[model samples]
Target: MTAEAETTTGSGTTTTSGRRPGTGGVTARRWAPGTQVLWRYRDNAGGRVHICRPVTVVQDTDELLAVWMAPGTECVKPVLLDGSPVHAEPLATRYTAPRTTARARWTGAGVLKLARPGEPWSVWLFWEPGWLFRSWYVNLEEPRTRWACGVDSEDHFLDISVYPDRSWLWRDEDEFEQAQRSGLMGPEQARRVREAGRAAAEVIRSWGSPFADGWEHWRPDPGWAVPALPADWDRAPARTAP
Candidate 1:
């Protein structure tokens, strides 16, 4: 079977755009429902943001969910994913790779899980933050998608959308009907984020910058909801985790 053979789903990342999906180019594909995926996050400064594990199953409300038996320090909202070909999988993640070493300095956290005993690569980025798997210019990983969020982090806006191809397009989340407008994202920063996703696809793909790698996984602390952004704290949307 090819590496993309398994159709599993867990939490990773996805894109939200009305644009079109691409069909030509070689890039990493997403997992099918029932496959496990683990994820870790870091800021531009390379500091640990937070870690989350989502399942691939679509909820009654059409939301994707993944459950991790975490400690008490973490909170995960049933992440709301937008875009095509979503699925749910049943598998627990195990963060392999050492976390305490000089070389592992830049690598913060990751999940560890077992797959087919002999499966070649145990962990994969089921979903990314910006978009789903597939497409060329838009097929880049979410971590590498450079974004300039709304000023002051208010209004709760996701600057740009990413696709499997890594290509990108400008987006005005505030333009959405249900969107709650916040501060402004400088035009320059917006343009950069919109262009970055597409431009970085191949450059990063060539170096293999993936979402959930064995070396970065870490078991969550416990069950909880993702904290509301302080900027949007006044009007933070209610959270629901699976």
Candidate 2:
């Protein structure tokens, strides 16, 4: 995703202007529903971006930044052949799972992710077009680190799912346990993660922010095209000098 230039202000707001080399200026536009932007996450503060997804803005208000990931959008993700945690493998092969891009599609229309400022996880609402309102998925990941083009974070490998009744379940307990056993997460870290999950559950119980914000009524613009994965999805360094 080459750009003419990017500038970040002291307040942590970033702006990218001009056309991306190959994508033309498809990404240069005002922030509004149907605008396409890359949502990415780095491995560390200055590490290479290992995950990237292009999504359309569903809502971009001060209280919430909601985006939609349409079905079959190309995305970069880490996976182990045996389905082991990426950090569980021996050091020699830990990050050698063969960098690959795959189609990321949900079971239905797509996923609508909602995030608030300084939150540790974003609430993702899933559904089928006509039926509506399936479930809410809280993806527990690092608080987003913003970049000129989009936001970034590392997935914590654990998540919570809240049904319409407000009851919740830990979606990837086995993986979280495995990550802990594999030394990827220490005891204290695990405890904090659990606390974060609890915090999210409380929000669900309260029907907070996006939940009460009426985003479920949101629909993408029919004229908006499916965004293509930037050519640099896997290789770009999110921050050149932090």
Candidate 3:
């Protein structure tokens, strides 16, 4: 999930300016590294969206796609009860309460999200400006379903962050638990989320494809635009294939 700069199209690989292999009228092209793209997630299956960020592409290949969400960028995130942290509120009022957009900047260095085709989760690496690796955040969510404009997935709420030394901790256990209590996620679904976290930790410990990839040294294209929040960002068709 991440856009536009000089690109080339030929053979199996095509630039965003050209059509992808399968889609008829939909233009699909590999966004070059350093290109800015929008990373977003919808709140409901085919309903309104709740999160949006302009991220810099790090790697885009047949195997995996990586993007960086830098700090200080204007981003859209969900807030409950006058900007209170979502986890701090009681479970009963969590979803029933008024939800609003919070204009926020990423506080830390930034986050690098790595997603593979057909995967259920994206392993996000957090760090400071100097590439000081902070931790790997395993965001357990719906497997990303690609669309004409960008990728879409629903946040599963539960997440895990793993340190450089391989130590890991649950980042949003309270929210995950609350969701279950609120009748949002069933026990079976919770188990699946935990399993996904463990799988991501294994990848971290082994220094997998993305961690070993040269993304830390990747830089954004100087001419890349600061992507704007589109008015139709929240809108998507009723069905999308992953």
Candidate 4:
């Protein structure tokens, strides 16, 4: 649903980091709170971006990167070539349908994304119109690759929804299965995604840091302006060596 940043040690304790974990031994500088950045996801089949949202940084330490995607922020999202919403299509042909990007505004309440570095999933907080805390959503995906403009990951389709009472349920399972059947994901990749889902479920069962972190009470700064969707929202990120 959304994304952010934080750090965890080998023992699973949360801590702060001045620089993000780097590839090729080069640490990446963290974005300051309130900085604008693009959060994006690439299509499962091709490396082309299919979803993009501009969000304001809430926190950017190595232990966690948090961001607020304010209501009304313009964004790019996938849609059927017929200009229909992707979810409106039948599951049988959803992933097989021709699709394209469409610019739209994020409606309703915004989301707070909490992500730990190198984790395969990010947790998101949602609220109702009056700021009534809704629930936490675990979006299982690949570890986000960070670049100067923002971060990118490929969605794994499988997800979990955690409620206030600590009860949780799997979400998008049909979509997950459909994706594999549509050839968007190979059998091996699907297996790994399922493994990641089980791993995330274990964390949920234990009531881990993010779910217990009190992010539901978190609110955005009143002074922070909503980030604009930039013209180059789909710009390719600079490559980082493994």
How do the predictions measure up, each by TM-score? Answer: 0.23, 0.72, 0.77, 0.89
* Native-referenced Cα lDDT, model 2: 0.68
lDDT of 3 by residue, 32-103 (tens): 665666778877423467898877776775468787776677788888858987656676677667777676
**Model 1, position 167: C-alpha lDDT score:** 51
The TM-score, computed over Cα atoms with residue i paired to residue i, of candidate 4 is 0.89
Q: After superposing candidate 1, which stretches have Cα over 4 Å from the reference?
A: 1-124, 127-183, 204-207, 211-242
Instruction: Write down the RMSD of candidate 2 (Cα, Å).
Output: 8.7
In candidate 3, list every pair of residues with a backbone clash: 2-37, 3-36
Sort by lDDT, top down from the best = 4, 3, 2, 1
Worst 10 residues of 3 by lDDT: 5-14
What candidate 2 gets wrong by more than 4 Å, as runs, is 1-30, 42-48, 81-107, 129-131, 235-242
Record all residue pairs in model 4 with backbone atoms less than 3 Å apart, i.e. clashing: 4-65, 5-64, 5-65, 6-63, 6-64, 6-65, 7-62, 7-63, 7-64
lDDT of 1 by residue, 1-242 (tens): 22232332334323221222231332323333233233323321223432233222111111122222221213222211321111121111111111221111112222222222111111223332223333112121132211211101111123333344545443433332122211223455545444544444333346343322222343333343422223221221222211
RMSD per candidate (Å) reads 19.9, 8.7, 5.2, 6.2
Q: Using alpha carbons, what is the TM-score of model 2?
A: 0.72
Worst 10 residues of 2 by lDDT: 21-30
| Candidate 4 lDDT trough over 10 residues, lowest sum | 11-20
What are the per-residue Cα lDDT tens digits for candidate 2 across 63-154? 46788888777777655665454656665545444443344443456888888656789988888668478888899888765544567777
